[model samples]
Target: MRDNGAIAVFGATGQQGGAVVDALLARRARVRALVRTPESDRAQALAARGVELAAVRIDDPASTVAALEAVDAFYFMTPEADNLEEVEEEVRVGAALVDAAAAARVPHVVFNSVFGADRFTGVPHHDSKHRIEEHLKKSGLRATMVRPAAFMENFATVMAPSLEDGTIVVRMPLPDDVPLKMVSIKDIGRVAAALLLGTADVPGGAVEVVGDEPTGPRIAAAFGAHAGLPSRYEALPLSVLRNDLDEAMFRQFAESSESPADLAAVKAVEPDVLDLAGWIRSTGWTAPADRARS
Candidate 1:
């Protein structure tokens, strides 16, 4: 077990931070969550669970510094875009947080980055995370960076249209044989929380984390089994999908699917990490009836 100390978690209401908070709490670590609106239900629930809630806007340097006071470690995540200044806002918030971490002299920092952040620049949001990673490395802070692969939960959003109609649509253009790794948001939290609470001797390093590498057809098969339907996976050309989505964003997804990181290397270090099938079974998704009833 790791020593119990106060840790400040930014974006505590969101997926990544929420997972970290749960993990820390499970390990009996004192957690301080920074939120923009403390009265929000999510914030209230966190407080009820024994999390110390601090009201602060990530973009405000003073507020961030105040929240970071006396924190042993920090978890940083940024907001996503909805087609407007998404990338720029993420970069700004990230830079501000790092600056505050430095000023507060926080000893340990962990950041959630996207897959292919170091190489793929087709999308601004992913690239924004890369910039933040670079900044954190040069800031002279002991940091651990986790670059997660495409989230399994993304199917709920990206493939929702098809799910609603009892069909599956492949929006990004990629070869049928091209394989991409996917992970559950829950697993991301589990691994992150374990790292935060364990004295695993990881400092000043980055890990490419993935759960499973499955091709488009394989993913469709998984979803089909869960949904209890004969779903079809069709590879839509990027040019066709571009008519409805941002071409730049679509291009980024295309590139990432084609050039995924080595899962063997990721699993080698984190041997206890969950694979796709294991994640599905643990999350109760294999049986659609159970998932819906829950």
Candidate 2:
């Protein structure tokens, strides 16, 4: 079991933060979840599972500072934004939280940044996180950044494959051979928990949390094999997305293959991190036929 002091988490009700809380609890670490509504169902469930609840609003950093005061480490991620305007608001909120953490004198921090955020990809949300990263660097507080790769969960939603002409097809604004680094939500948590508890450290004080590096064809093949069906990947044009932010993100997906993830580095921290095939199997990701049956 990993040894960790008390931890306070912002965005605890969301995907990344919630995963961190789960990983911390699995390690028997004390967790305080900062939520805007203590009485919400999700917060109540977390509370029932032994997570301490602290009410906080991003507009009021004082509430964050108060919740953070007694914690040994703090984990936080900015809220997801839909467009450039919301992206600006994300920067503001992140800056405020960084200032709050400084004021509270939190010993350590773990920022849930995106993979390639350090690069000026010009994707609005990615740039937003990088701006926060810049603020954290200037804050003078010790911080470890866990940069998450493409969420494996996306396949269950927007990235889901379609059955056309009796063939399963996964289409994305990516070329067939360009590699994409992917990670399960659980591994993101495990990696962050390791950093927060001092059980693991990255040489640069930042690590891109990644597991599998699969090309588009490989991704489709993995799903196909898992579902016992033949599948193919169709490379779609960026214009098909019709959203500037998403188009930029997919463009980066192609560009980033030049510098792929170091899988060994992540495995050193969390040995059981799932590969793409394993993740597909673990999710029991269904083909179109199976979903129709359900």
Q: Quick one: best TM-score, which candidate?
A: 2
Flag regions of model 1 displaced more than 4 Å: 1-3, 161-173, 201-204, 225-231, 239-250, 253-260, 268-272, 286-294
lDDT of each: 0.73, 0.88
TM-score of each: 0.84, 0.95
Q: Give the Å error, residue 1, model 1.
A: 13
| lDDT by residue for model 2 (1-294), tens | 224557988888888899999999999999999899999999999999999999988888889899887689999999988888999999998898889999999889999999988767888989999999989999999998889999998988888887666567889888888988899998999999999887898988889889998988988888878877888999988899867888888888788889879888899899999998888888877777633333
Clashes of each: 0, 0
- Poorest 10 consecutive residues by lDDT, candidate 1: 285-294
- Let me know the TM-score candidate 2 reaches against the reference structure: 0.95
Scored by Cα lDDT, where does model 1 land? 0.73
